[model samples]
Target: MADPRSQVEHEEEDGASAGELLIEACRRNNTDLLADVISSCGGEEKAAEVLNNTKTVLGNYIYHEAALRGNYEVIDMLLDQEGFECDPINTREGDTPLHSAIRFINSLPPTPPSPDNEPSAAYNLISMMLEAGSDASIRNKANLTAVQLLDPRNVELKRLFQEAAEEAEREREIAGLEAEEHEEEALEDDYAGSGSDSDFDPEEFKRQQEEKKKELAELKAAKAEA
Candidate 1:
């Protein structure tokens, strides 16, 4: 029989190999290789842990590396990972993957419009990241948000990011209103259940008011007489 110690060592080596492959797969936008690496990770939980925790010497996560290269397929797959973080900050520039993506787009030379008028791959990639919950408003160490980092001449991309930010703001407002409504309802329910009104007597309340008014009138008259 194989020794247990040797078996464990082999598994460790396999895991390390798979991790290195994962990074390469992301960098190269190799979805097939990435999928294979995920399978080799032994399970979903392990895959997620590896995907989330893997970082380069420069502190870029796999997601950041993929975004920096405009690797749409790899980014899409990474986003689908059960516990993958959409906005992990890299230590180098404190930039989230979204920021890295914008930087990549900004670096590219201008291209002519597509004949079909379909969005460009960069547009699609950034859109997917936004849809996956990457915050466009998150600022990096230089204090520049992803939207702000966008190339000004790229009006189409600017509009895309602006619309996303607006939509996110609207969603937040709606959520805030919903939370307030729920809070108000809860307070109403608590007030109803508190029994404070159960023993209330309208007649007693009116009588007490009248008594207070009469006392005030008498005091005023005595002061006038004096």
Candidate 2:
């Protein structure tokens, strides 16, 4: 992995960035460079942080750049990392990466889509985003989700979004169940550390009672003599 530290320092002195290498890697489908630089920076999660924090000139996140460029492998690299934000809205357009991908497809010249071609590059991109738990219901500044922006004639994309939405819900449900199970387990461990009155041993109780009675009898005798 090429250390970007020196490049960063040089850029600082001249107020010129060395260029966005990760974006370039995605642009060229260079996963090896992507993995090298990311792993070199840190592990998956740390690399995700660095990439997500950096944006294009358009103020779009790394995911946005990858999706717009139709870089599936790059998107997978970033999205597979833990704690990635799949649905990132660009500052200028208030459009999530899904919306960006959709808009890119919509802008293409009209063509007769078939099952052989209905799942266009745009469909695949949006599907990937949605599968990663992107919220399809989230509205942009225009109060439209990415699905809403689609041409009514494009039934394929709409149905794909619908499936993605369902898959996202299932993912959320599973996550919720896992969290609940963890909470329940913690509660059980906490309770196990705290014994109830019923937990007292009979033999220990009898021994304690006998000792207390003996002490009381001695105290009463001493008081009477006094």
Candidate 3:
């Protein structure tokens, strides 16, 4: 059997094999051939077969090839399928596909397309992986979270990952707050509509809230006086 990388690279060169073809199509952003292949291979099922089960005799998915090439659509296609592994650490280095992509981004020699280029594809893909459930907290064999995978040399890459992590945390907090607010609003609405003042006295509720507010004011006043 061919080496895993060789198999992907060879088929990538030849435009043969579904996996190789899909990776190429994704790299080129050729949604046309992508659609055709999806049609023939039974949509996501055939794609999953290559991704989940097929490996070079050495054991690697063609999907990993797509990721290494920075093909976000292919990543999205695989992720949209149920149960596809978003965080497969390679046997060679215990690095997930996200790690591989970040590694590539960091190691590139300075040239025309420098790391400072606007709105990095790597950041976009990493965001996709995170959204698809890639765990930020998983320490690699190096005991580093995927965020730490960024090269210390590339301050920009580090900043990008930091921003993405912060954004994810902010979104989670926003979602939690929204959920709490929704629950509180629902409870208020329910109480207002169903519980009669005679059955559940408004005066009693007002008195309790007023007392609580007064206590809070006293506590603040005491703290200020101190």
Candidate 4:
């Protein structure tokens, strides 16, 4: 059989369209070819537009194709593209690239124990996607989130997804709290600027100040008399 790498090289040399090159690069995990495709788009700004727009007839984006094939390097490169979306949904199942990655992982045989005790390649790839802001809470057309699609026997993978989900929730809560605090501060500032504090009266404040001065003056006069 002809070498797939050689075929991809041939296609590149033959001047395939940017979309075709991108699909091939993602499928083959050909980072060099993918880089060439991005450069062909003129620059990073335009590259993101082209990358996001390139999709298969099946309605899978380049990121989805890369994730489905477990193309780690290609996915990494795609994520770095300026303005590249981490959560583009495929047309068929409303599945994000993260969902596609889980599907690929589910198809694999259980990973053999590694001598070095390192994380499995699948684990690393999913972690990378999560770190890149792929929302695990996103549900596919089947009403299943990415974590829900994970093979139940894969306990370690499940833990990883759970931890990521928890971290995301914490970050969201922190953001919400911060937003509320800012709004409260803004309201207080507006109230102060508008002089609309119902409990505060300028006349009462002046009267209190005069009373303080009178008490001080009286004390000083009594000390002089003594």
Candidate 5:
């Protein structure tokens, strides 16, 4: 239960756009505020509904901001929405959320010797994006896939990303095959219905046959009477 007053205050005082509210909430790691704003939308919000689409003026998706700050909770909420796209590319670098996170990681200070103890936020963000079906194979304007942008020394991150990408690809292929099967079945049923009416015309054929039989019997009776 969000405080309606908070929403009112944010809207009236700050005049915050849904995208703004969502991005700010990600920066603050505030999932509640993010949920409140998204819930206000009718769930059919599109790019035309700019205020509620969770995209910035420059076409950066809310996930872009979340990735920069390692806000996984906000990322999770956005991904759960009906029309959420995990791999929306920012025009600046044609970078997806995964790309943004990779950039953030590249800008970080060198990892200490005990890197395992301090797991990278970028690693987690990459994993989440991949799991949510971000195409690992999509190249940015620089023609660099998310895997190509990885820090070479981060073997674990690359492996996890590659594995998730393969899994998503397999799922997509399976879904496509299922949809094709259903479409074929629908076409076969439609053809069967149409062909039965046109090719057979069973009722009309039966009526014509009955009329011919009656005529032949009448002729036989006439001959016998004569």
Candidate 6:
């Protein structure tokens, strides 16, 4: 028998291809085919043209598809393409892509998995989008950010996005610190380790490490108590 995915792929090819096809490909998580179409059709520019023709915007296109389907590859593709704006205010609703992504994340049905699989695909996608530069502060037509669009009744999605944003911020901060420390170390090495090779601040380093250990211990205790 013919493979089911192949049959679907054939049908897509036979139909009149357009931006909607691209969107559908994203929704279906068909990254390879999506990339091919986008590349052949001039990528972001062609996508922008489709948006113009459809009276839509690139942000809307990406937000709707990726948000609804938890398609991280598509979201990353859209985010990485330079000059494609995502945080634009919606003309009608005044909603930004961030708002849409949050709304869609909240709407997704929960699919619990065994330990190996993630409990939520939406969480991962949201995290990816944020890391890719989706603005967490952009508000929607309702004067709400994606965080606000989350139903209070569904606290989990709200917490998920919040945690993702916080985690992204933490990662960025850690990277910056690491870079700064590396630069400082490079500078020290440039000094040729001459001015007292014992200039290394062992006390400061130990203090910082001790603080980290204390924080980890507190966290572990909290988790254990919970």
Total colliding residue pairs, candidate 5 = 0
Q: Write the per-residue lDDT of candidate 2 for residues 1-226, one digit (tens) a residue.
A: 2221112211221342323766677677778877766766556655655665666666776667766667788887877777667776777878887777777678777767765654666667777777677777879889898899887777778888776666555556556655655665565556557755556564665575566556555555544553
Highest lDDT scorer: 4
- Listing every candidate in turn, what is its Cα RMSD in Å to the true structure after a full C-alpha superposition? 15.6, 18.2, 9.9, 15.0, 18.5, 10.1
- The parts of candidate 3 lying over 4 Å away from their true place are 1-37, 45-53, 69-85, 111-135, 189-226
Local accuracy by lDDT, each model? 0.78, 0.66, 0.61, 0.79, 0.65, 0.59
Model 5 misplacement above 4 A: 1-14, 42-52, 110-120, 168-226
Total clashes, candidate 6? Answer: 0
Better of 2 and 4 by TM-score: 4
Off by over 4 Å in 2: 1-19, 114-118, 166-226
Name the lDDT of candidate 4.
0.79
Q: Candidate 5, after superposition: displacement of residue 96 in Å? A: 1.0
Query: Candidate 1 — which residues are off by over 4 angstroms?
Result: 1-16, 194-226
Error of 2 at 131 (Å): 1.1
- Cα deviation in Å at residue 179, candidate 5? 8.2
Off by over 4 Å in 6: 1-20, 41-59, 110-119, 153-156, 163-226
Q: What lDDT does model 6 reach? A: 0.59
Over 32-87, each residue of candidate 4 has an lDDT whose tens digit, in order, gives 99998788777776676777777787888888999999999999998887788888
Q: Give TM per candidate.
A: 0.77, 0.62, 0.57, 0.78, 0.61, 0.52
Candidate 3 structure quality by residue, lDDT tens digits, 1-226: 1222323222333437766566556556566776666666555654445455434444445455566677777677767765566666555566667776676666666434446566556667877887787767677678877668776766655776676676666566556655655665575577889865556655675576566556555555544553
Residue pairs in clash, model 5:
none
Candidate scoring better on lDDT of 2 and 3? 2
